[model samples]
Target: MAQETDAPQAPPSAPTAPARALLPLILPAVVVGVTASLVFVGVSVAAERLQQVLWGPLPDALGVGRYSVLWMFAMLTATGLAVGLVVWKAPGHAGADPATFGLNSPVMAPAVVPGLVLATGLMLAGGPSLGPENPVIAVNVGLAAWLGARLLPRTPGALWPVLAESATIGALFGTPVAAALVISEALAGRPMRGRLWDNVFAPLAAGACGAMTTTLVAHPAFDLGLPPMSHHPHAKDLLTALVISSAAALLGMGAVHAFPYVHAAFRRLRHPMLMIPAGGVVLGALGALGGRLTLFKGLSEVGELARRPEGWSAGQFAAMAVVKLTALLVAASCGFRGGRIFPAVFIGTAVGLCAHALVPAVHPAVGVATGVLGMLLAITRQAWVSLFTAAVLVASPSVLALLCIASLPAWLLVTGRAQMQLREDGTPVR
Candidate 1:
């Protein structure tokens, strides 16, 4: 017997293009981008100066070696106290709980600005394994949205947060492309009527402008001056990189799984004054164990680690990674306002260096890049950003191929795992 014929399927509809942003939209985007860059750079410079004083002549004059474990302990403990005070006194409790704030959170109120700035600066100058990215982004988004509302009262409210976040990210990485990748990932698979690139337009424009402004004000280097990569990585090198990177990814995953518990424990105290300082004491002890090089947000230290990978023994590198990871867990869980991306980069560098120390045959550039790739992918769960950061930091064409291949195994290790965020009510924020 003949089977019933299946009905013919209708042709798929062509995708609709997003409407172009008019002059009014572009104007506010430009304004927001410039303002965000200035605010971010200003905070960064102020924090740098404070760090120089705290870790420099101040320590020297006090007859304490800057690298002393005891000094790190004292400074970190003091930092915790200062941040606690800022959070306690600042308006709006510094704009929502940081534990609940992911990379893409709502715009904070302007009232939250002072406390965020103070706490972020303290984290930077103190010995926390956190960076200013999160707090700075919050400040810029809040301030920018307020400014945008004033300038273009009739504009869509959604545009402001996107523009502000894109601008801050651009200023942060010194590149518009990084912002695009990050935003694109966040927006992926969401139900939207327009083409993805169309949705990307305004943010891209803001990011480009922000990157330009940041470059003019401060020429920060993402590349850490790693040695030239040798000839194309060998097969064995790729395999070794996969192994090393996977290990690092697993290490970060361990922290991710523990994040919620640690954050909840800290929250049990229910007061920033009690919670923050106690976290600080734990961080100080970790800093003491890891040494001063393991302190801070770790951008500059990553360069140092990359520049002289040979100077560190395998045991030393392991110690650095363990201590820094511990410090990151404490600082983030204890309510310090900062980003984990930069510190994760440092941890990845330590992991990479340790691999190199243990296995002499692994290329330094390959080892370092893959390790960074793994940690970033695991911590942020952003593959493109992780790849971009790793490639830019090394600036070596030869290692890129190996890093790309190594990332697959690393991704497998991290996929479907708990995210490194703390949510209220004991629910994990993935």
Candidate 2:
């Protein structure tokens, strides 16, 4: 990776810093900047290749349990290897784990950005089941810091780091709104205090970056998946929306709360590095037990669940929900580095299915639409983003309509409760 300095985007005339100050910042910036772009891109490409590796004909020679034991082993080995590489060569690679990034209190060594990106990509390509979101944010901050430091080449502060981080987050994640909120929360830099100016520009920069990234990445073929989640107003629909959103809010909260503890417990393994592969064993077992109903068909499961017939009973869907949720949590904790996006979709789909059972007359898709609307809003803590994510998942205006209505209440409920519990995750809405 050809890394430049920490100069974010300097004007033609910026004063030179003392040689002493400039030297330290440049190396880290170059290493971090180029390394991050390389590793993250590698992971994205590797994700496509991983499918072939898992189900290829050679699996028979490897073993019968390719998707089960072998896959898990591969994931674990990959994660361990990545950790080993970083530990041996780039000691500062794993400074901020997932939760730390989520909370925005990251120890970003922008100087070591390349090492961090490589480490993160290695972890993800191996299948730790964590989201791409964390890596993206890490790179965002790392690059931001590197750029800021290089440009000024003098007295450097965290202001550019914060803006660059936020903006990059916005551009890359396609969730600029969330990136903005994250920056605003992090500005306090303390436990809980808000700075006025930091609050304003953080989102602006992040959102702008996010918008730009989305535009660049999406382009003309921005298929964005499904149609928007909208619905016609109705009294009955409104009633169902309330119940579904409230339940989803509670479930979302419960899930987030249990996650840290769940992660801390089982992941405490004898071979600390092999935790993910060990987790793969558990995940494979769960999938096998759940049957094809909860297998790693990727987002295929989402499509099937969405098209579920009307009057789908809760009993049939319950096991699927438990299995999928367990798989997601374990896969993540065990180190299958993927996004929570699809898992959230599954959770919302099940919630919709169950809620639909309560109102059998309504389409299952409609119920699912509503459930997803709530689920997305609950976790993201951003309604527009939630609405947009859910809307892009299906092929019907009806579902989109229901999503808009359902998401409104869901956002209000989730965002309110999150205001309290999320202080631990780094967002304290003042």
Candidate 3:
């Protein structure tokens, strides 16, 4: 649940480098980008394969429905034990108790990468309501920094983390624009020597290559396949967008407020062995209530929800939203190694669907997009990513203006609120 950022520090003095000097970094950036994408895709494929084994053949052979309440409970509990063993026994403890560190935390040692990767793969495969972004970024950052230092001793030590972070982000989202936006947000208010684009140059190239690599290999898609809003923006639609986005933001803030309390409860269990399996049990129960639609990191599930919105009632969507939010809280609290963004998206999609079902006038695309915008803004506290994600989910140019406007009020509600991350002492990250 740690929020991601570009971990490396910017230079203290504002001294612009010559364009030619930066040219040397481009090749390395390209390499880093492609490497990051391969790592991301590799881990994802491995996790998916494991997931198939756990949720597919094994269940069939056992003569139990893979997603039945009993099977869900058993599988999730077992997953927790497996990951708990890795965390308790593995080196670096899966890289600093995922709850305590953000993506911008200091680069980890290369020695810790294997354990982190294993734990991440397990969580992703095990159906935890978390995403691969955080630990994956940690893995890449550690590897990139350690390897980059050896290969390019003459380069600034800070450059590797930036490149790795940007590249992995591009791979994750299947677009360099996401990487560019994330890096640009990090650069804001920092003392930098060069023009903004100059500073962004190498990372941008890395992001582009990373995005291309993932697109070529995996063909990830973010659009939820909702029917496009055919009419021009109306005054009522704008008001509806604001209302839904603000409500969703407030809803997400509820989870943020509850994060520390839930995390503390797990901490009181005092061992990963106890805490994680206990979490899995709770997650299983929630999944039983919410069904399979509310499980996992939520990208594909959200797509499914959008594809057949009429199949579920408003109450069903509401229940899914609540259950997913709770599941996200418990999973992140109980020492699971993953990110919050994807689950938050699922929660948002559910909320949006609920709104559309209830009111009928709220366009599905508008409801879903603004719902995501608000939830992401509250959870990630990153404006650009929130806007980008919400916009991308609907994939409508017409919705962009509405999302941008809706985000303004939603951002206000979450701006000074406690973020959905915890400090070592279990306090919310301010």
Candidate 4:
């Protein structure tokens, strides 16, 4: 009684149980990594190879100019609508958008993951403009959450799944450390830090898995000559880079603003499922309208751009840019899930083509780099990220210099505009 009455000793001042209760992170992270390796790389490679074999011959048969935005639009469009329908009609449902990256919403609805993946397969098959990265990320996150809830041992040992998430994220990004950071930031609300060992290996496993898988099935995710790294810049070139990069940023910011409102307009559909799938299919068909402007995944096209920076006629490039932008917009709003990264590349390439034609002083390579820089600016709202991505893409210090120089003015133009805010996840906020 005396001991109890002494303010109950304040219950020993309380142990302060973990803010997050993730305990089983040790083995799960490894599993997540291994699974991602098998699933992601396997899916991407199988899809890519099939696409090549089936559609690869079409361009040659048609004597196409190289690639077509029209074809891309049609395929992605169909994919979007199909995905929308699957999500709507399917029993399990997960939702996606830029918000998925933020984890600001509930982990996916569980039912939707299957539909999204299936739709992604459709998109890949149809030659749409969607990227697997976004869907894969969603799938990864969803799996982590579901497993964390179900499999982890009860009695205060939920830490392992959290670690698995970190590792999986890190592996997927091709940067184990970054994946860790990404997982940390994403799980900040979840309180998952006490078990370090459990989480550390998750990313390692996932990274190894993703890397091996990528090598087995697909070409390089990113490749630029090391020699390009040696290129230096004159003051003038630096200035150009600055201007171009800035312009790219501003453009990106503006796009963030515009895409949402347009999407909103499309959102009021009484039958979003039907609308999205129909929209996707229509867009795919629309892509076909541009004649040879349609094709599936532009990886080969990107290679073509690199190979013959000087070869593409200015007019053809311009057409490609317009069609690509339209295709991406339609694909996204219509319900297909994918990142806009590669599409942005196409846009930038177009901008580069146009810029070189208009400003003959600018090298085509520099111009392409500038376009990519600007689009990243639009997407990330982070100048530094844009700069880094752009610089890395060209791998030419000289070109990067020019793009950085261009980025300033672009920032100036883009920042003040209402269109640049992303919802704090570095995605377009609007």
Query: Which candidate number maximizes lDDT?
Result: 3
TM-score of each: 0.94, 0.66, 0.95, 0.72
Against the unseen true structure, what C-alpha lDDT does each candidate score? 0.85, 0.54, 0.90, 0.57
User: Candidates ranked by lDDT, best first?
Assistant: 3, 1, 4, 2
Query: Top TM-score: which candidate number?
Result: 3
RMSD of candidates 1 onward, in order:
2.6, 11.3, 7.5, 7.8
- For model 1 the local lDDT of residue 330 reads 86
What does candidate 4's lDDT look like per residue over 1-430, in tens digits? 4454435444333233353433333356566666665566665666776667445686557665324664455445545665676667665543554322421223575677777677666666666665665666666666666765677545233443344444444444444544544444444546454454343344555555554544554445444332252346666556656666566555555556666665655555646576576666656665665444334445456656666666666786767766666666666665565656556766676667566777777766677777787776666444554555566566565565476567767766666455422343333443
Show the colliding residue pairs in model 3.
Answer: none
Please give the distance, in angstroms, between residue 419's alpha carbon in candidate 4 and its true position after superposition.
6.8
Predicted candidate 3 versus true structure: per-residue lDDT over 153-234, tens digit per residue: 9899999999999999999999999999989999995877668888999999999999999999999999989999999989
> What is the C-alpha local distance difference test score of candidate 1?
0.85
Model 2 per-residue lDDT tens digits across residues 1-430: 9987886785454334445643454443333333333433455556546644644544667666656654555544545555545634564534443432242435477656666556555654444334455556566666656565776656356655555455544544444565555555554455422334424443454455445555555431212243233556467766776677667666765666566665665446634355545665665566556654464423555666555544346876666766676766675454333445546667777876776676675555556656666665655554554565555555456656566666666666666453212233444332
Clashes of each: 0, 34, 0, 61
Preferred candidate (lDDT higher): 3 or 4: 3
- Residue 3 alpha-carbon offset, candidate 1, angstroms: 20
Clashing pairs in 1: none
For candidate 4, the 10 contiguous residues with the lowest summed lDDT are 97-106
